[model samples]
Target: MSPKYDDVRNSLLGWLSTGLREEPSTAAIFHQLCHRLVDYGFCLSRSTLHLRVHHPQWLGTRIIWVRDQPHADEQTVAYDVEATDVFQRSPFHRVIHTGKQVRQRILIFGPHIFQIYEELREQGHTDYSAWPLDHSQGRRHLITFATDRSEGFYDDEIALISDILPLFSLVTEIRLKNQLARTLLQTYVGPHASEQILDGATTRGSGVTVSAAVMMCDLRNFTQMAARRPRDEVIAILNDYFDLIAEPIERHGGEILKFIGDGLLSVFPLDRPDACDRLMAAVTEAYDALARRSPLDHQIRFGTGVHVGEVMYGNVGSTRRLDFTVIGPAVNLASRLEGMTKTLQRPVLISGDFVKAANCASRTEYLGNHGIPGFDDLMEVYALRIDAELHAR
Candidate 1:
């Protein structure tokens, strides 16, 4: 390599390390790299990066940078690993499968090579090159660059890119690992709990006491339904019911901690200013689970209980397996209220404490104080007014 090219390569490596650490986002890093490459006389027109991710809804993310654009555009596509006809003809696919760099003189390559080549040629791009980046855990990534130039890239420019590929790949891999951890955690646990786990709260018995609104709900006849139906059918029914319960709670900022059998437990902590409002909203949303109609004309019903009090929230379990959830009298009270729903002939019940905390006494009907097991005093309960909730909105 020439001395000038060597200097540019060293500078680019230094910039990659600093940019990866200082910048807060992947797009920012991409923006900086694209600018630096142009400054190094690469005559870049467009660049694209594809990364495989572990997610339920998405297969991977694509980052695209175009000349003269202030920032990169990003998109996520569903994971479909096998090659389709389009992929078979893509230069990117060729580089990934062959594990080698693929360079094309766009003007010389006809439409028979790939449809994309014809489009790029029409768009004034003269050269295209794709690099297969190998990351940890056997995951492979692809990055492609295009230049619209008279002579395309010279031999030294390609050699400089080859020399700097390892450093570029290292920075990208680090960012992707962090992203994977975030996406997986958020998918499994709720967002707030995921943040705690990522912040290093993993040990058993690591917990904090917090005042919050707690909710517990379960299908009214799930046990009987499961017994009557096939296992697969029962599972599908349960998922549908759980989704009806979960969507509203999540939308209103509550985190579902666990699902035990047919029942789900969720909490809305009193940390934010509007916690009570959101908790009330989530309570109403839980009622959606009861109101859902099945396409098969099968009857599905549920009951919900809401209460507010101090509870221990955090990790609890064996050393090998830990569950991050709430524990205390508040959780028990919520469960008891849900059980009382069947006996009281009510679809939803709210503890007096939650009513008072939420300032919703006018929206609830008093259901006479009743004694609960393991508690000394009679716990006052109230029924949530579904009609009042609808009218109020």
Candidate 2:
């Protein structure tokens, strides 16, 4: 091996660390790396640079980035989209087909792959090497290196990337999967979601304990709605309903605990008492939600209940099924009030305790004391008028 090779390799390593440290996105890092590699003669002169990224839900640690420099005309947006599609399926179909690590040389730039090559040329790259990369955090990514010169990545180049590929793939996969799963959770719980649930972050708000507000909401007749409607229609209606109701919860400082079947449990002041005001905002939101979404099959009505009191709150659950939850009387009362909405013939109901807790300005008509089945007292309740109070909700 040439002595110069080590210098070039070392240079590449040092240069690549900036990407690792700052993590300036895969594309920006690759563009810089490719330019430096070419300038140092690792790549042929005048070669273009093109790169792509793909992540799957199994590989953790590194991101997969694919690099190729095709003819100028070939690097269209459509071409890149196709490359991403290939990256997504390649791990399942091709890469993983050979085991945890797979490497091979193929004439991917031939006439059969001309459009791909053209895109590389359009971007100024002529050689192509499809290598998958991964990083810690469970994200599976792809690094495809392509250049304008004939012949693709050299043995040493391949060796360097090959050494890191497996670990990177594992990392990328894990990160990707975690992110995807988090996205799913947020979608289910609504925008006012917890970092403990979505980002896996946890820290105490303060050592001192404080009172908080908890709110609960449920579709009045989800079982009947699903039984009567097709699945697609149900999903469409649900999206609309959630969009209407969940936004206001998030607009204020509320954290959605979980989406329990058709019911949602959410808490305010989980982070602190600032969320107390959010309960009222949630009331306004729920009160007006049915109107805009009325077009998407208005037969479904929702019952929402809010209660304010003290509770211990934080991230708790099984390691595998960790949940950000509030487990105390307040949450239970909020849930029971939601159940009462059905008997009371009201869509939006709040405990007088919650209204006083929120210091709300809106009209809050009280419902006489009535006992809940489990807890002893008739929890005093108030129903927020739909059009009057929640325009800002």
Candidate 3:
């Protein structure tokens, strides 16, 4: 390589090394790298980085950088995107699936060329090339470059980019893996629990005892709905129900620990003075939302049980498969109360402990102490007054 080219390569390598140490996001790295290449006299008008990620809702993401733009644009690709004809005919699909580079000059395109090539030609781009970006464990992604210059990229420019791609891939993979870890953790577990696990709290039985308002929510008649409806329809109904119930809990600063089939377990840790009050607010909002959906063809109905007590919150289960959750008499009491909602014909049941902690005795209707399974003594329970006038308070 010429001296000038060698200097450019070294400078770009140093920048990539600094980016790795700084841990900037993948999009930032792509934007800076594209600008740096342009500054180094490369005929680059646009660049894109396509990365497949491990996510429950998305298949991958595309980061697009245009010359003179202040920032790159990131677009998520859904799981079913690959099945489309546009994807199958694009250069990205060829490069990703074949693990090979695709170089085409727009001026000499054939009739059977992909629609993207035709679009690029219309947009004044003269050349386009895509290459597989290989990462660890044989994972392959994609990188593409396009130029509007009539002469396209010089051979030396392409060679230099090829030489530096390994370093770029290494830096990006680290950030992508870290991002994937956080995404998956937050998806399966709640954000609070995910943060704890990420901050070196992974050992089995490693946890802390915390005073919290525990809430358990279960969908009413879910078994009958699932058995009667189509599998896909049942899943859709469940998702809709969860969205309605989980939003209020999360908005009130509660962390949902588990989604057990047709139910969920959550807690509002008493770190703040109004923890129990917040739990009540969440319960009220959830009930109201469910009520609003009564006019729908398939309305969703659920029961919620609330209590306040100290519980152990942390990892528990088999050595290989540990679960980060809460467990104690408090959680059991909450579960039992949820079950009692069916017999009591109430949508919400609050234990006496929760009512006392929340300081809302005047707003609740006291139900006499009732016999609870597995407990020697009867537990006092209360029901929220669902009247609009009282709930307005």
TM-score of each: 0.90, 0.65, 0.89
Measured on C-alpha atoms, candidate 1 has an lDDT of 0.83
Give model 3 RMSD, 1 decimal.
Answer: 3.4
- Residue-wise C-alpha lDDT for candidate 3, range 103-219, written one tens digit per residue: 988875565378888888887888898988899998999999999999887787788888899999998899889988999999998899999999988999999999999999898
Clashing residue pairs, candidate 3?
none
Evaluate all candidate structures by whole-model CA lDDT and list the values in order: 0.83, 0.58, 0.87
Best by TM-score: 1
- Which is better, 1 or 3, measured by TM-score? 1
Candidate that scores best on lDDT: 3
Ranking by TM-score: 1, 3, 2
lDDT of 3: 0.87
Candidate RMSDs in Å, in order, are 3.3, 7.2, 3.4
lDDT accuracy of residue 150 in candidate 3: 91
Q: What is the Cα-based TM-score of model 2?
A: 0.65
How far in Å is the alpha carbon of 122 misplaced in model 1?
A: 3.3
